[model samples]
Target: MRFGIPLLFGCVVAGSVMAVSCKRGEHVWTAPDTVNIPHNTSGELIRYGRELIVHTAMYLGPEGKVATISNGMNCQNCHLEAGTKFMGNNFAATAANYPRYRERSGSIESLDKRINDCLIRSLNGSPLDRNSHEMQAMIAYIEWVGMTVNNGAKPPGSGIRELPYLLRAADTSKGRLVFDNKCRECHGTDGTGKYDSLTKEYVYPPLWGPHSYNNGAGIFRLSKFAGYVKANMPLNNARLTDEEAWDVAAFVNSQPRTEKLFEKDWPDLNTKPPDVATAPFADTFSAVQHKYGPFGVIVKSRKKH
Candidate 1:
């Protein structure tokens, strides 16, 4: 499953820039050309890093050649286009913004710490040794991807978009309908996703069940899931409305998945995001309210304090 080149979907080359079409009226961002990677040992590491991201499951999954760890899902499954796509959870600013405080850990985290967070939470896998070649390659690729971004600045479309909260709690029934109609073709009716045996990876990653992201993964949050869906779901034909996105997210997340308990997360309860989907809240909102929100009230209450 290793590839010499990184995956670049729906991109058009103009001069030296790669323009990827985005949501209507959104500014297009340029991804650095892989062609520019130097033909040296450093470039080899960078290329290996891209392969690690694009084929993470092959190298580091349950039956991985490197290690038997992650839940058989590639990092690109969520990061999208090896973390290059705009508003598609791209890594456009990650390199420049590390050693920053994250309320989740309540401490300043290095880039490797953040990568391990994704390994532990998103991939539901054990952390790669920070000193390992795999870890260094991943760091090299991510840093090279974001080298042009100014330090401490998140460029436009660096992460998931934020959709306004629905006036009502997101409806699973409605979400099921949206999933069946839009998502089932690739992800399957059971939401098990389509596995490509030849490639030894999922063509479409599962939305839920034992193999999907754990409860603590960022996409487990309805807002993040909905926003990600709105921007880049249903594969090539992303056209879900905000309401549809929110509902489908609720539907997908409601199904069973692995759970991760992190006692240290949100040490300051007040700093927790509104859609954590777990308990021990600083507010009086029910777990249901936190998970499937008519979250305007919860949000408003948080703002006043």
Candidate 2:
């Protein structure tokens, strides 16, 4: 399948081909546009889902009508551009391969489970009732966006791509400079993010603070955060070197933010990522070492096992 640039009506004329690969193998497919939604119940549900994702805070924040389970951040904060843009934590493949096994929980999890995990961790709040209309609507939108994908397949560029680990732990001092130069303009020097007064939501969400993602959010993980920075930070243009990405991540994460929960996370110790914020891991490394760097050793050890 070939994808063209989407028009206002959701139709594409011609553009570059975006290749996607599933767990089975590489294939090409076009992402559907919200403009193409039919006038029907299913379309309404799908549209509702998109609204929930893009404006989650309005519906799920502390003052939300649907539920109060997020830190006033839209799902688009990390999922980026409504989960459509590639390498920006997009949801292009999420609906296709969920209800699959995840190392974090050490069980076969459903879409609702995955959504709740973000709610609890990234959103830094409680979980939505799995049967709730909000949850169902969000799922509907993800499924609609990914409906073209085959089940059990993980398309290439499905999620945030990883940047190579640094030779040593990231240097916060250097990272501070990088942040000042590249990120501080939008995220603010203090990392408190710029807000849209009219919407009462952040245009550039806080990177670290009470309102930011707690320590348990996936963004708290060094590699995940670094990769995301390398691929999508500064919006529109992403030109950070791998080292800059890592250093900036270290600098940002080293700052103060909300406390994290989840004592039972990564039930299978061996499956834990090297940069998990807390300790008591399958390895004999210290919590500080785990949270910081020289993660190549951890990666090598995991491979050996």
Candidate 3:
């Protein structure tokens, strides 16, 4: 899949998220405090990353083939605008925070599995195995982010999370209040998103539940999740404050959902469509969307400013 211009990927510095566009044919290497990635390289790998972003946008556009949103905008529409602002845990540091974590699968999981899950949810794409070239390249980009956070040191949570400027920091109490007001309606009091047995998936599976994460998974943190929730969550219908977004996630993730131990990084594994383990609302899920569904992109719905 091809991509477009450098749109997202910002390094969190001094509690501030700074946008970093990966240009084509560039391999920059700069000091810890400043971003000085090379800008004029004739390298294939670097340019590939740049192109992928653009191409991905085309597929996600209004007229593109397999467009996800009904509003008729490209993936680039949402991604280019506030992708950095809504980086959430999409950035690598969040992945670095996990290696083996408890998953809803009743087992410990890894970062790669989490990535697959995100692609399914956010990117609306198929999952890439742990060993796939695309997955590795994306990881490389994240590792670069991890390196930056550690001030050029290769450390876990080494990316934006470790930047010199501390973000707002995860605050649980405040977050709880946010969840109750905005999120509680759909996700339930437990933070578990609703489920549909017939659909064999969650309608609003809790972020932290029996179908959620625990010890072996990347532990839930606020900064990243907040960014994501603020912009792309609740089906991209949120207008939450940064502090509130972070706070609500803190409250939700604080709960114990599922903490057995499972592995999700199956380099050679191919996943089939989910077979619902025990979805109480399975039939309900199918009927709801099929009956009263709103198709296409709906956010910032207007095409022109």
Instruction: Give each model's whole-structure lDDT.
Output: 0.86, 0.81, 0.41
Q: Worst 10-residue stretch by lDDT in candidate 1?
A: 1-10
lDDT of 2 by residue, 9-128 (tens): 222223432223233324433468777877899989989989998988888987787667788888888898888876678887888888898887788999999998888778788898
lDDT of 1 at 116: 91
Which is better, 1 or 3, measured by TM-score?
A: 1
Q: Candidate 2: give the clashing pairs.
A: 21-155, 21-156, 23-154
Best by TM-score: 1
Q: Which stretches of candidate 3 lie over 4 Å from their true place?
A: 1-169, 260-305
Residue 157, candidate 1: how far off, in angstroms?
1.5
TM-score of each: 0.91, 0.90, 0.38
Per-residue lDDT value at 185 in model 1? 92
User: What value of lDDT does candidate 1 attain over all alpha carbons?
Assistant: 0.86
How well is each residue in 159-238 modelled by candidate 1, as lDDT tens digits? 88888999999999999999999999989999999988877888789888877899989999999999999988787667
Q: Which residue segments of model 1 deviate by more than 4 Å?
A: 1-27
Native RMSD of candidate 3 (Å): 16.4
Model 2 misplaced stretches (Cα beyond 4 Å): 1-30, 302-305
What is the full ranking by lDDT, best candidate first? 1, 2, 3
Per-residue C-alpha lDDT of model 3 across residues 216-283, encoded as one tens digit per residue: 33324333344456645555465676556556656665676544323433222222111111222222
